[model samples]
Structures are given as structure tokens and as C-alpha cells.
Target: MKKSILKWCMLAFLLISNLAVFAQGGTEDTPEPGDGTEPIDSKLIWLAIIGIAFAFLYFANKRKAVRA
Candidate 1:
């Protein structure tokens, strides 16, 4: 039980750190064609994606429990 909790904590930390690392916008002066100077906030999109992932995991676990 303790090991499982520790593993989950580690996983959460790693995932959050990774997302932070990637979320950093480019430091260059010139923006790409489609991309503008302003950063597009995708908080809603991220929430939706995370929600979907959790929903999938929840349903999958429920299915396995039903089978067992």
C-alpha cells in the first residue's frame, strides 16, 4: 500500500514536471506562421484531456472489477 502510494506520487510529480517543461513558450523573437506573439492558453483543453484520461481509467478499472 505504501509502495503504491509512493509510486503514484512519483508519477504525478514526473507528469507535472514534464508538462511544465513543455509548456514553456519559445524564447525566439520571431513567431511561426500560424502562431502569434501571444501564447494560446489551453487550460480548458488540458482539463478536458485529463478528464477523458481519468474517465477511461475509471471505466477500465470498473470493467476489470466486474469481470473478477
Candidate 2:
């Protein structure tokens, strides 16, 4: 019972700190990537490729485990 109460107190503390940070707003050094830089679409394509590769590897391993 004591442990559960401590866990909840910790969770509430974390939530309150997160809310405080959000209320402050705009913590970043640079305005979010819109200042005449190269477009992000190419970077997004690379990210998609990386995601697909990981998914393919995951399924391949699963298939091998099933076969074994």
C-alpha cells in the first residue's frame, strides 16, 4: 500500500513538471526548420526507407523462428 502511494506521487510530479514546461512555450534554439532551408521531403523519404528496412528485418526473423 505504501509503495503504490509513492508510485502515484511520482507520476503526479512528472505530469505537473511536463505541464509547467509546456506552459513556458518555444524552448528550442531555432524556429522549427522553416528558415529557407532545403525542404524536408527528401529526409522524410529516407526515414520511410529506414522504417521499411527494419520492418522487413523483423518479419524475416519472425519467419525464421517459426520455421525452426
Candidate 3:
């Protein structure tokens, strides 16, 4: 149980960090695309991908649980 809680805490920390980094928009390394002024935001795309992955996993687990 302690290990599980620790794992969840780490996962939450990583997710929050990723969100903050993504929210900050393009950095020096990323630079601006063609405009050279705007910072492109891609959090929505990231969110969509995460949502789809979560759904896939949920269904997969449900199926496994049903089978077992």
C-alpha cells in the first residue's frame, strides 16, 4: 500500500510537471515556428492523446477482469 501510494504520488508529480512545461508554451529550444514570435500551445493535443490512452486502458482492463 505504501509503495502504491508512492507510485501514485510520483505519477501525479510527473503529470503536473508535464502540464506546467507544456503550458509555458515554446521555449528557447523549441523556438517559434514560422512566426518567430508566438509560442505554440499543444496541450490540447496532449490531453486528447492522454484521454484516448486512458479510455483504451480502462476498456482493456475491464475486458481482462471480465474474462478472469
Model 2, C-alpha of 67: deviation from truth (Å): 0.4
Error of 3 at 39 (Å): 10
Error of 2 at 9 (Å): 24
TM-score of 3: 0.40
How would you encode candidate 3's per-residue C-alpha lDDT over 1-68 as one tens digit per residue? 99999999999999999998888454456545676655337467888899999999999999999999
lDDT of each: 0.86, 0.87, 0.84
Model 2: pairs clashing at backbone N, Cα or C within 3 Å: none
Sort order, TM-score high to low: 2, 3, 1
Q: Tens digits of per-residue lDDT for model 2 on 1-68?
A: 99999999999999999898788454556555667755578699899999999999999999999999
Q: Model 2 segments beyond 4 Å from truth?
A: 1-40
- Better candidate by TM-score, 1 or 2: 2
Note each model's CA RMSD in angstroms.
5.1, 7.4, 6.0
- For 1-68, candidate 1 gives per-residue lDDT tens digits of 99999999999999999999889666656766666555557467988999999999999999999999
